[model samples]
Target: MTTALIADDEAHLAQYLKQQLAACWPELEIVSVARNGIEAAEQISAWQPELAFLDIQMPGLNGLEVAQGIEGATRVVFVTAYDDYAVEAFDAAALDYLLKPLKTERLLACVARLKAALGRPPAVDESRLAETLQRLLAPPVQGLARLRFIRAASGDMTHQVAVDEVLFFHADDKYTVVRTAQGEHLIRTTITDLAAQLDPEQFWQVHRSTLINLAHLVGTRRDEMSRLFVRIKGHAQELPVSRAYVHLFKAM
Candidate 1:
């Protein structure tokens, strides 16, 4: 019943890994497959799959960066064509590393280790893994503090919106819209930049251009096609939830 995810830019390799995994560990359930690191990260955050097989080099973000940002219990396994990253993969606290043109024997051994690890109680939570991996892989940067307030502008006035009071942040054309219970204001910051300053648990990236405050999330809706959408407090319109983030609401 162990859920897993496979991430690789090479479609053929990803399929090959899936085939090998079926033979090596038939009991393992693959919850999703991602073609890029960004999709991998979003899926991991949403599904919290127990195991993630990741290729180091991918668009949007690298495998190391994706692994460093997961806020869940999912463990990572590096699958790349290069052996040079073996040392750094270990430094990133990857459960195991698999080289390209994967060998049956090696994969079986990895399966054995994964089974052992899963049989035992987790020694560390997902947050610790992320922090450790980030320390090892990411460069030090300033402005690490979370935002407390945002300057939202309207025509001639700039309103200071408390971070907690905001409902959601939406990117519209060139500006990002800041919504609150009272009204909406404009800000020029991108969703990526705003997300970095906000706590991941409080705000969620529901769409590529939208970061919504979980505190204001009232409900979710599904249409005839089973497509999902979210309803926020005081907002009449239901915001669409991208497929990458749909797993986050699985329990809801």
Candidate 2:
């Protein structure tokens, strides 16, 4: 039996995908399920499964990073919630991808393709994967409208804040705090959800719980402990930069 692995942060979604895979390809054996990209990378290294179903966005390393870390050939089927632009990129590189809220028919087609490919020799083109990843990670080109304003709540009042005026976002319990020069406002959205909606070039996730507006970034400083902290213009608060994301400010 062919062994496979599923990596997704959402437990429900991962289980659903596994169930669908079982229905479509009973011969495939799922060896493990990973909760995050870091765990997925570890499992991939240890088991080296023949196939991996990777979620595009995760806490640690993203799916593309995990795929690049694999030592041997492993067929990857990316799962993402992105729209047609990303789908077109996947198609251009001839890579397999499954859009979110996956349909049975679409999955069946993917399974059929996987089965056919499994019968043949491994044909993973590194160059193509690299090109695809580059396109996926890069910020969107000009002319595309980005998030201009955010609606946040303060007490019983709802306020619309311009994106440019925002300083940063912090994950607090079940809600996210939108900080600005004026004050802090609460939003029910999670940082992960906000990351998808914000402009990549304008906002950068410096830590798991923090996403900073790049336009307001003053500079980075290293504490006595050698930990990196980011300073934003007009904000006395300094944000910690997690090791996983420290590379983002290397050139700055």
Question: Which candidate has the top score in TM-score?
Answer: 1
> Per-model C-alpha lDDT, please?
0.81, 0.78
Q: In candidate 1, which residue pairs get closer than 3 Å at backbone N, Cα or C atoms, i.e. clash?
A: none
lDDT (Cα, tens digit) per residue for candidate 1, span 1-252: 999999999999999999999998999999999999889988987787999999888987778767655545578898877787665665546788899889999999999999999887655433344444544454444677999999976778888999999999997768899999898888899776887789989998776568899999999988765667899999989887754356678877
For candidate 2, lDDT tens digit of each residue in 1-252?
Answer: 999999999999999999999998999999999999889988976787888999889987787656655544567788889867447545643237888999999899988898888899756454555455545655434564567899986678889999899999998767899999888888888765677678889999776568899989999998765667899988998887754465567777
Note the residue pairs that clash in candidate 2: none
Q: What is the TM-score of each candidate against the true structure?
A: 0.56, 0.53
lDDT of 2: 0.78
| Model 1 stretches astray by more than 4 angstroms | 125-128, 141-252
